[model samples]
Target: MTSKYMALPKGMSESSFDAAIEKFKKALGAENVMIKDEQVRPYTKVMMAVPTEEHTPSAVITATTVEQVQAVVKICNEHKVPVWTISTGRNFGYGSAAPGRRGQVVLDLRKMNKIIHVDPELCTALVEPGVTYQMLYDYLEENKIPLMLSFSAPSAIAGPLGNTMDRGVGYTPYGEHFMMQCGMEVVMANGDVLRTGMGGVKGDKAWQVFKWGYGPTLDGMFTQANYGICTKMGFWLMPKPPVFKPLEIQFDEDSDISDIVEFIRPLRISQVIPNSVVIAGVLWEASTCNTRRADYTTEPGHTPDAILKQIQKDKHLGAWNVYAALYGTKEQVDVNFKIVQDALKQLGKGRLITEEMAGDTQPFKYRAQLMSGVPNLQEFGLYNWRGGGGSMWFAPVTQARGSECDKQKSLAKKILNKHGLDYVGEFIVGWRDMHHVIDVLYDRSSEEETKRANACFAELLDEFEKEGYAVYRVNTAFQERVAQSYGKVKRDVERKIKRALDPNGILAPGKSGIDI
Candidate 1:
């Protein structure tokens, strides 16, 4: 169909690339096949501090059906062409919708946004890849259904399918997205459909209720890997409780972080604090209210300490901010709130802000909204902090201990400040683990700044790995480097699985750095 193939796939000539895409177009349609340079620009937007050219997609194939996806994968396998997949293409701060490798076609599943089923009695919903959190939330509201949705910070546009596939976290009891999922429908690289959990059996009414089938479960293999393209997934939704209490514990001193995690661990593990506790540094909370660094200073580099302190003072925030909520009956909330208040009071410094105290402001307002299943775009303000449109989330997982949190905070802060960048990060306390997430935000427009950001990121990986701290998730730009931090034996096993599942390497060649 196209007389030209300007951006051919790797090792492909104009004629060959055109022929492959023509076959893809036939499976869907010429209108759905995006090959023009201008047509694929939307898929090239990368928020990471790297050159945008490397992330540009050669073409984009918008598949509206599972059968169409199977046909497209077959075409890619036959032509030895790499393929990248994006659910809604709204995965900001990671890579957006860009393909992992250049010249690979993006299989956009946004058009297949179908809320196939929502069983209120079972609190389960089967959704296609294109079904976004906002879409699902609106459906519940329009139908006047009494259910809550646990979603990431950027909940308005990000989809549950993509977030769960990437193992993204949220702020509710159902915070672990993947664990909340009970089923998945994936389109394999060889053009075959496989259903995990109870979906494997035909006419199985318990497909959405039972997570594991009769044999060895196969759902974990598809997550955060290049193994398959998930077309549909079933996620468990939270039933609305009678009482909801959002709590905030703001500490004044840096030394207080040494006790924050330790104090919260028991409460979190015991289920007294059911939701994931969000421990945010002052800068993270500040960005939600303050738009740019120049609002406090005119310096082209990192904001001065004095200015940051002034921002904290002026904004009425603390050195660190902790947000979590108590949900259940009214009597249950009162008892848990008193326990949380008494334990957190041991620090003898923080000011506990109740829901009544916080009005229409952030980070309290936004955190409260997310905990209640209300979707908002408040987290997008992080990109506006430096004003250069660059951000990379450096997330490292550690044990839920005070010493570990202190060590990670100290090391990360020193490294970040040494690189002339500020530490805009937070810690989401899971049941047994703490995810220390750092946003390496920088000015992409400045070549010098981008260079520093890249070096800072590389050093972080190197130094953290030496300390036995490994990032749980990373953007596409540093997947290769981050992959090595886990060691070779693990990498070898991943590569073996990739080779076995996708021999042609046609599906996301360098995703999480798993390739032949």
Candidate 2:
């Protein structure tokens, strides 16, 4: 298949590429292997404007069966070709559904989406990589089951495997999805399959319950790394609470963030706010709610100083918003909500706004976390960037380092401003750590904007690293830069792990910038 974006590297041979494609088609079946330009084109680009020319896959394969995935991996291993796995391709702000390396085959697993088992007695479900939150919710509702699963507010199209693989957190008490994962079925680079926890031992009931193995806890090794392809996983689910209440608390001053975070830390550790917490800055709130307002859209290339002026004039500057939920029996929710309200009042701030939804109040009951409500930012179609374009850099930050976060935000805004780009999304994930997602939104049609966005992102990474921040999740485009952020020791350790698991270095080469 030929594509304008498919620019083969120098010294690469057409004969070699064609042979690789033929071998892949033979192994995975021609029907499952996509060599047509139309099928391969969309898999070439991610969400960011960082040109798709660098990581255009030679083929896009949709594996409907684990046996097919194993066959494809074997063929790729023999040829020493890289493979990048993607599920649903709904990973917005980061890279959409694109491989991190060029000439690699994209393993699209959306077709394998299925909820294999939902055990109400154990409150756990075994799901394939393709299962999404919306799908799970609909199925449970249809079956008249009583349970709640945590989900991100962005696109419900994201797969359960993709989100958990990235260690993405949600808005419920069980917001830390990866932590709840008990077992995983991974396809290694050499085509060998491995299962973690009790899944390795036949007929063990603890396969989806206990996380520890007799030797090592290897579940974390698969996350945020290209060591293997996760086909199946078991995750814990929450039982339906007798009563759920969503609450919101607004703070008028920026300084209040530190106090608020401190107040919530103990509560979180005590399992009071077990799900997750979000402390959204005022500018972030304004961008999502009032984009149509003349105040925001009127000025193109508005400086940070000007935006701050507008925010202050609008009485929204330094407005810190928090979302939290209360679960359990009616008495439990009532008692918890009162305690939270009283705590907020002591801080000289507290307000409750009624949510639009009534039944199953799980979404609105959270005041410290932001994932429950429908992610309003996604409504603008900002996450979906057509063509080979758009990108996001997510990093974890300490909530106590409010000053440092402010500095980082300032630096990011200044860098994007210099490049004539917008710093679109920012929010807190864990109560004490911040997930500052900077969306480099630009039209793929504009070559200049795309180039500027890439350069600006590179520069921002440098600044963020110098300031002692680390990336939680990175795209294949900036793999090298992200790797450089980690110190020599950590990088060395990561390389060793990669080499041990993938000796041939044929799985996701150039991804995460590990040479192993």
Candidate 3:
């Protein structure tokens, strides 16, 4: 049975691959290495439209310490086996626990769960790869620390190190995860540990407080790249505010999306809205209330606008829901609240909902939880909306202009409706940009639907590129295609760097299409 599912690395015979596995088992302990069919099955599970066999791993090596990671890298280099590294393996819509290509080893770093240090005065923390948001939150709460945490919606299970390295965002003022990162300890391809930023200095006191070192900064290179495996990281923490006010604005018309963005852009740019604001669509907000597609219609195609309007009415949801929060002293929040309320009233189409009005209501409750720096898994309800456990996040960066957002929404909806799928999307507003995130939900159980989903995703990539819009991140199935959109010169330069750092191509070879 094990032999039936065995997938050896390219250019490696069965016997040679067996020898490499033995070395891996000896380096990390026999129990830490997994090569059985059942043990390796979970590593190959992917939610993308592609086949799972395409991302199968030859084996899984769990590392508990930085030294063990170095040992695994050395063995892979010697055997010419490619290795794909994952921090907690909970990257959900983005290739969770899977390799970039077939037959590469999976370097699972989840066993390295340790919170190295947390300074209450400096509001800084040094943590291992597996220190999850919930874990850190519990630590701060237990110790009576006054620091707050900002994390992605799946904050209960997701870790900061992986999300920060992947450049994910949260709903708090410090939503840009990577921008808050100060330093990191990475395990290089050559089995050496390189510390970034102020960490390189002996007896460094400000490693987690200072971001820049004396020379060139290398922290940005490791993100979204396969240059090194980050073992430990340091980042800043936001201090708890004197008062927190989470609010929502509901717009009745789908056409009001442009006007809504136009109004919010100035507020965000001027720092009047201190948190990362979320403008979610009707379907996206409805999904949070446990509403399923089967409830409204059993039809195979996209749900009609009539039924969508009905759902919005039944759930008391707007065509678009805007969520943002204000933090600071009581006086500061009072002044900002008045400004927000007056502006929305002047806009005429929006109905403002404060914490008092939205008490314990779903969707709003979860959104409020996130903006207030609490951990919750309420957003996971999105998986049940389509009901086949298929989700792909098609995220594109756009200017914070009203016209640009309207154009993107129209194009995305047209393409999705053409493929018999619903458009469950949102716009996460930044100071000068918007992360337009659209979850391409489908039923993977049906062969026909799976094929259609694959085609739909491809068409989205092609059409968006022609319009000069590109996705910020994609799953393993489309990484190579998305990398081409950047141009040949950038691709060539990335390859040169990959070769210089990892000559044997032992790291993730197909990652961003940059391999030696």
Candidate 4:
């Protein structure tokens, strides 16, 4: 017979767990504390190569105020109960809603969502963890504030606080979410409230405008760590430009990746292309446009290159699709667009497709929307590529050099194809770096495919590391392995910090593989 719950924290007695749940209910109100298996099931849903049971949360606690969060942390410390904190719990492909490991109570902060303040004049905002991109966008629109929001593709559901804390990038001038952040309000594991940057100063006027206060900047420390739960964040917003022009340069062959990066790097570094340029593979583009594996040959192994070529031909797509935009006044956009056109001309073969030519044609439409600071869920089409309800983001950072990108793409494709999976990936071009994001898609319903996907992810990690490459982030199942990639010294330092701040390890014991 199954116990009353799916799982509990290791070494904790059932009676102790019950007592902790009682205390949590008392602190968060009965409606906020959820313990039933069904009520907690949604938080445990994971899309990794592992079973959902592996990441199942023991219970869920929703906190609407910092005082409630402090109380929860105190109780967790008191009972030595670890809690996994999530802002909106919309972290898809990176363990959405699930804890870093099994049995940790989920501290649901979606209820704390509040757009605390917005200064249209200064183009800054102070928001709680639950304020989603769509929420802020709506707020700006309803109030007639002329501001642009740069958010991840899943902007409709994901929040700024969570995305910034995770260091997620978007497709705009202020795409580097963390860098755009000015301040933060975090609840430490010891039940203390810590404000970073200008938030610490009493009646500080520049809390949302200044990122670095006098002392050591602690805003970054709380990110991607279990040391604290972030309740509020402050960040800058791009003022709506007078004119926006989105463009796509399509390259015919897979080998053209090298030339694509070579030509684009200079323009990006020089700020001619101000937005985060995305060089998406054909499959990635196709997937975003609702193309499914079933549309092509589905004969088990990787889709044949011949079929891929045919899809490109039929859909009027390029093997390597480059997406970026020009924003400024009419004259400025025209000049920048001409400069971009001149750069693409250097490639000698990039087919430039403008917004008018795209004409609501998928991928490009959504991509343009993203580059223009519009929130959309169209990128979720990646799941329909394999139709297995399984996906893991295998992201690795690399220099924005032609040869480096080519090498990484070749290596990734070789590894993925060797395991009979397709290489559906993209290179998000930054100022001087590329965030090579690959969605490792598989059909979890098939035991064989699931096994292959798991093995493929591990081998991808191993082989990529051998080539001096490591992932920037990973799903819950592989946090420990990814942590090892940073080396032992860093791990030791993190452990020391965890011990110092969270002696009882009550806040997400396995988060980023750090624990007391």
Candidate 5:
């Protein structure tokens, strides 16, 4: 079951590989390199489909310092071998720690994890590639600091650098994590170094805010591309808000989603609701929380209609759930809550709930805790959803016209259903547009399920492209489909950029499906 695409170079000899292994071991201590069959095998296969039964790596080099990373890259460049950079190897669906092209040595960076600096005055933090959200959260809370951390939904174990590099979104005001990043230190394709923003200037602190040069914005070039190894990066931190309130609005019918969308658009753009607004369908919440037994039935004869009926009977089918956070003064939150309630009532849909629903438990307070950006979900054990294998696709759409949003949702659901896959569509309302993240979950163990999932994803891409919608984040498994959405012209332009930045195509070669 080894990947045919991942074999050693066609004519590579034992002596050549042995020589490379010796050089790697000499550069990095023997303990830092893992070349055993069991160790290197898992690093070879990705988590998209079930990993191949056997995986053999030319070598696995663990770099403890940036200098070692440079040495590893230098060696790979000299030998024309590929190098794959992995931090924690938790990138489930997008080929975790596995190189897209075969024969590449895995560059594990978990050892480089370090919170080098936390500048409260400048409101920025410098971290290595291996720092996890959980680690950052613990540091912030243990110190009882006033700064806020914006983290993705499953903030328990995912690395901050990998999430930002992939453009992961969170539920706080600074949900766009990548946009919050200011500067980075990248090891280019030929073992050279490049710094973004003011990082190029010696002894400059402007990297905490300024994000542009006299010419182009190079930071974006590193994201979702085969550009270079991002060794160190700095991201902006949210100042602790005076008050945080998490609110939810519930609905009971499918047609009411459009009404809810229309009601929130103005509030989002007006800065009244500056954070990311998520409108999750009831089914999505049920599936994610495992509260709806109807959907997770183990019986072979289960039907969607039966599941829908059960959900309705339990009154758990809250046609939709809207989640938002209000920051500022306590008075401002109270005012905003009232405005939101009143607006929903005007549309004949005001049945709402806050932490008040749990009475003494205080769900609002818990929502505030989440808004604080601390990683607390591990205690609940919900982090084990995928059995350690799953993928996420982020699709962004504008809400200028509610009808168009509805149409897209309908088309997406129909396609997913056609393939017998479960999908949850969440609406992330930005200032002027909406990012409808369609979270698709499937079992990687079944080959039939894997093929069906791929087909459904491909169909959705074709339909969305024809309708003028763009996918914000795509799994490495479907990179080609995602690049095609940008059209031939943009693809060519991206190719030219890749060639200019990475002439050897050594860094993240198969990522984003961009070729030189």
Candidate 6:
């Protein structure tokens, strides 16, 4: 059953490619190995500023079991083929499921979805790569398991395995995804299986509970790198709280961002507010429900400040919106809520929006849902802000200081406006660090807009680096530049590790720009 001969992997002729395809088909069945044009189209959708063909997958192989993944990797190793892996393939702004380089087979693992184990006593879970947040949430609810999940904004469609492996963030107290992970099961490039942390000990019961397994921690390396395919992983789940109260604090002026950061840091560090707080911009709050720029104005590029003020007034939102929560029993929540209230009150610029007042609002509802471990897709509405469906998340990390937050915001806004783009971004305040996430939204259909967006992204990197600021995560297009933002010695060590693990380069080649 052959459709048409398309491009093959590098250094391989059509016959050799056909032979590799046959081997894949034989290993996973013909229905699971997708080489047809239509079957591979979904895997080619990329949001980065690069040619679509450059990131297209040559074939897509879906495996249902760890043994099947091992067999497929063995075949790719034999043929000197590179294989990119994805769990649920819903990483929207970060290239989705597309490989870093083109002409590689996508080891799509959506078929291997299974919740292997759930320990209610320990509040731990073991799941396959395909076990999505929504699936796990439903399972816990159905079984009346009193455990909650920590997931990103795009939670319902994204899997825990993919998000956790990427070290993504959420809104809950367990917002730090990777920090909460306890165990991981990886399928190496050489077709060997490994269990990290306590999972290495045979018949060990603390694999998922105890993270440190006696030696150097290897789980951090596999994350955000293409060293191994994580077939299964175990993560700690947030136990059900006796009480939950989510709060929203809105400031009237954009300049109030500095004070908000200053005030919230003490609360966050003091555990008065145990969860990660989102200090979102005005545009970010509005975009959750506002679909088009034309709705307010026909002006192109960044939305005018007057128009933004109008949006803030009409939407009853703030120049900056802060979403945080209080957990524990009713007594504990009341005490902590008072502490949070006092913190905001001292700022003298923040207006607290209680849960009752913010009932079913844009940023408020979504933030509450995330903090409670309920998955929702309302965050995707940001893609419709400028139309044309172009997006790239430019995330840079900084100290959770108000002054640093203010400086980053000002610089990013200036660069974005210069490029004729709007600053639709937010700051998720960690205990001591903050992730300043900005979505570079533009109209991909317009060639001019695309060109400017690309230039703007490059300049953002350069200017940010000049200010001693470094991006924490980036889209697939600028991974190399982001990697080089650090010194050469760091990348040298990464390359050495990549070569040691994947000598044949059969794993992801350009992932995070570590191609050795």
lDDT of each: 0.89, 0.69, 0.91, 0.90, 0.71, 0.89
Q: Which ten residues in a row have the lowest lDDT in candidate 1?
A: 1-10
377-408: candidate 6 lDDT, tens digit per residue = 98888987898888999999999998999999
lDDT of 2 by residue, 80-159 (tens): 76777888887766777777766777888988988999888898889998888778877878897787777665635766
Angstrom error of the Cα, residue 199, model 2: value is 1.2
What TM value does model 5 have? 0.90
Runs of candidate 5 with Cα error greater than 4 angstroms are 1-14, 50-58, 292-296, 299-303, 312-317, 359-369, 378-396
* Clash count per candidate: 0, 25, 0, 0, 3, 0
Provide TM-scores for the models: 0.98, 0.88, 0.99, 0.99, 0.90, 0.98
Best of the two (3, 5) by lDDT: 3
What would the per-residue lDDT of candidate 5 be over residues 1-516, giving only the tens digit for each residue?
Answer: 553233463356656766777788899988887767767777765545434532334567899787888898777767666677787776654556666555667788988999888888778988998898888877877887678888766567787788898887777888889989989899887777888998888888788678885467788888877788899989999888888767777777766767778888888888678788777765555545544333357542222655654664564446676778788899988888778777777877746777556353322333445566766543122213323344546475665456767887788888877877554667877777778877666656667776776677788888888888878776666777687777799889888988887777666666777878
RMSD of 1: 1.6
Report the lDDT tens digits of candidate 1 across residue range 1-516.
Answer: 553543568888877887887798789999999888788888888988788888888888899999999999888988898999999877677788998877888999999999999998899999999999999999999998888999999899999999999999999999998889999999999988999988889899888899998899999888889899999999999999999999888887777897888888999999999999999988898887755787877766566778877877988888889999999999999999889888867756678999899877777988999999999999888877887888889999999999999999989988888888988989999999999999999988889999999889988988889999999889899899888888899999999999898999998999999997
Error of 5 at 245 (Å): 0.9
Of the two candidates 4 and 6, the one with more favorable lDDT, higher being better, is 4
Candidate 2 to native Cα RMSD, angstroms: 3.8
Deviation (Å) of 406 in candidate 5: 1.2
Q: Distance (Å) between predicted and true CA of 207, model 3?
A: 0.9
Considering lDDT, which of the candidate structures 5 and 6 is the better prediction for this target?
6
Q: After superposition, how far is residue 300 of candidate 4 from its true place, in Å?
A: 0.6
